[model samples]
Target chain A: MRIEANTRRGQPVTIYVDGTPVQAYTGETVAPALLASGRRAWRVTPWGEPRGLFCGIGICFDCTATVNGVPYVRTCQTPVAEGMVIETERPLERDQ
Target chain B: MNPEPVHTDIAVVGAGPAGLSAAVAAAVAGASVTVIDAYSQPGGQYFRQPNPAVDPDPQEPRPRAGRELRHKAEAAGVRFLNRTVVWGAFEDLRLAAYREDTAQAIELQADAIILAPGTYERVAAFPGWTLPGVITTGAAQTLLKEQRLLPGQRIILAGTGPLQLVTAAALVKAGAQVVAVLEGASPGEAILRQPGQTLAAVWGQSTRLKEGWQSWRTLKKAGVPYHRGWGIIAAEGKDSLQAVRIARLDRQWRPIPGTERRLEADTLCLNYGFTPATELAQLFGVQLHWRPAQGGFVPRRDEQMQTNVPGLFIVGDGAGVGGAELAMVEGQIAGLAAARQVLGDSTLTRRIEALQPALRREQRFQQFYARLFTPGPGLDELAAGDTPICRCEGVSKATIVQTIHAGADTMHAVKAVTRCGMGNCQGRVCGPLVAAILAQETGQSPERVGQFRARTPIFPVPLTAFTVLTTEGAESAESRN
Candidate 1:
């Protein structure tokens, strides 16, 4: 099978969630991989609550986090790259 | 911060046959086009399972047919976003979509929008259907189509729909011993629905039928027992499906008391019919009409496939459940029509008109199959008292019956009482079954069943997709509890 390696080919990377830096393989979708890496909660629900990945697919949009300087990247589908800074605790208003 | 919505001349939702054709046609007509779809690859369900060995890669030149058309579209610079889905549409043709890699919403303002979102396999409820081995014919087909894997060695393909026949045939081709196909339609009834359908099945597939007959003549030659008027009363097994109990039905299609028979099988595939992925269309607020010919409610469109919303066209199964050929032809017509609508080209309009006959023939043929393959009345007979009506919520037939008897006349009432349709899948799979039961219980028509309540997040979006602390969460009580 000619595996179409994800957009980011074998590039080692370190992604920091909050202030903790952890090594991760390249081309891994952020959310599940981060959870696999040991982080559990991505954000707090608007009503001063905690919410994790509710819908792994893009439909729920619950796994959003800041990638580098850009906010609102769906961690589940976005592939990781080298030196990518991921911020999970910035309070932002819901789109709805 | 709200990002500025990107503006494009034409935004085609879905990259299946219809959307692709529309995008190509619009682009060929000199309009900037953006084609978005959910799949990581092109080709919707029909062409979805193209074997890597069979399909051409991006580097390779186009396949034998339609090479030039695709090349022209590519040269015309149509932007193909393979893994994007249109969440919904707002007034003034604003399309809300999300990329596959990032669920982050993207907005697009389009002068014209064509929805070719296609259809999904519809599953009705039955006992033990949520068991591991119970899966939709479409799901099994996906396994075969995408991964080239057979579902099982011995399988029973059940339910009423054209998909059952084709899937049984495909599974057999993929080296499976299909024990039998439990068609809900009585033989005479199924054959009778064919003639009024324009003789499409016979004329269109005569060559293939001839081949299939010769190969399986002995199987049919001997009384291998294909119960003409029968339906599955219950699916039973532990951990996985080991067998299904079927019963013969009377003229009114009720299961006879003593005719119940059990068949040994590993996998049970079922499909009542399919419904168009109308989320986007409904979001656009396009007028829709219930067409029994097309399966169920579909967007209202003219012969050219244009919806009431000007510059917005629909094609393929999304328009109605015509097969791939029809989808392609409709795509061509819609593509051409959208092109003309954008360019106001009389020549293109004439060309589109010329293609209408073929498209109509295809639709008529589908109408035949739709009627022939429509779910038989036997479904009411098979939802036995013990059968679990809602697989996701594990609500049983007896519970629903109790709810119905206690004055819960509608599906919504049943849901309000039993919480059957409140699961993540909404009512996509079990809705039709519950509707059938409710209609049967109340002596109401099936149309009334259409009022089943549906919840948001229709698709089974993985919960893992949204979480950041994936490891810690999944590693905790989730595994055991």
Candidate 2:
């Protein structure tokens, strides 16, 4: 569970995670917003092990998720856009 | 057709304190400057500003110094290309970058380039380090500084360096239960080893000393236990971090036989120190020298911050792991020198000369800190055969050992055989560890084992971003013929 540390600024926006509508604040990255909503594991490795936010910066690329149809978008670096869709799981090949 | 490359008097890669300072100084010296950074915003990592759109508390004050320098740079007409990753540095000081917003490839040619790519946190591998809640201390700070988010309810700040103290204080202030702050170096030994130097360093840097004292007091008042000469041997967990195994270390940093203890913590923040992001420097064919004090292999720079390769300058943590203050000073010297080199400005010489004393003082402090927190021999033994050394590839210690035993002697050969350093991170995360392992196996120094040879496209860029560039390449080739 994520703790709210401070009052978030900006208008509340809805971002879809696995097609589920989740509330997110503007100006926040997808990773923190997902974490705040208690969704920590963003991706399963090719080995099928869960991983998330090892390095919060873009360096590690551990927090990558499918955002707006782009797979492997670094959630930590990509700011949340209104109505953005983020998928924790990699879409199947046919979906591409 | 290939678009004409954008030319600038000075191109600064990275917008951190060092890059910002350099850009501002260069622009002020009447050189047209362009600062390119991968982050969406300026300030690099040290002065990371919250995203205004998503920041819940916009009123929270950001690092004023970095912000001020950024503004000054903007006012001085420094062009900033944010969210732009310079993927390759090629012949004639040309740079290829991918702009995130435009989703296009851009080329830049600069008379002089200053690389301040900064550093990334170093992690000594141990069992369960790949767990979800196991993160680097810098990662914790990034969450707190950028999002005001705490890593976990209960956190253990483990590793060496003054950063651990600062991180613990920040965690406590952010309402996280900091279970303990572990330091590999004994405070008494650190001071005793260089009494006169330590005293002089503290005396010379009164402000830093005061800040350190304040952080100490804050941690003490919070009743957080601070353990010196102790380190995390391993983290224990299933899917996420549940606890960390800690042990007291001897002078060589080897764990004491009877000092093993386990503490429950959802989050284990580990950071031995930092490794300089020198891929760009290496790609530019600039010479690198291993100065254990400077973290690892760093680009060799002269007093003016110019590398052995002409027109390529390096500063900040990219040059070496000197902290922000030294980085800023070095940035100024490099900026002024670059501007003078390009613009034939003689007046900038005095300004560069003026910063020497402050630079020397900061260097003295850096040397002291490097000695105090250099990862000890015990850290080398943390990763067992099963421990994952390369997280990106899931290459284990056993795999690396097997590869080495199969006659892969150099880092390059091992990388070729085991794919150790060929990850999304470009080996930034595991290069040092692999080098250390190779050194241990061969009974040679890490420098002799060597670093991975940097190749073009230092960072991964989207294939789609290159479509236009591919056609442009053909056109350019035809035109050249």
Clashes of 2: 7
Query: Which residue pairs in candidate 2 have backbone atoms (N, alpha carbon, C) closer than 3 angstroms, thus clashing?
Result: A8-B56, A9-B56, A26-B53, A26-B54, A27-B53, A27-B54, A28-B54
User: DockQ for all models, in order?
Assistant: 0.04, 0.59
**What DockQ class does candidate 1 belong to?**
incorrect
| Fraction of the reference Cα-Cα interface contacts (below 8 Å) that each candidate reproduces | 0.00, 0.62
How do the predictions measure up, each by TM-score? 0.72, 0.95
Tell me the RMSD of model 1 versus the true structure: 10.5
Q: In model 2, which runs have C-alpha deviations exceeding 4 angstroms?
A: A1-6, A90-96, B54-62, B467-481
Q: Is the docking of candidate 2 incorrect, acceptable, medium or high quality?
A: medium
B405: Cα error in model 1, Å: 5.2
Q: Write the per-residue lDDT of candidate 1 for residues B1-481, one digit (tens) a residue.
A: 2256788888887766676677787788787888887866566666552333334432212222233444556788988776765544556676656565554556677887888888766665566555545666765665454444455556787777555666676566556677887767664566665554445545665644564464355445432345566777777775457888888766655678999889988677877677776766655556778776686778898888888777778888978888767888888788777777776777897778788777766766676667556665655555557666664456788999899999999888999899877754465556667877888888987775664533223344434323322222222111122
Worst 10 residues of 1 chain A by lDDT: A1-10
Model 1 spans > 4 angstroms off: A1-96, B50-75, B186-228, B250-253, B398-418, B452-481
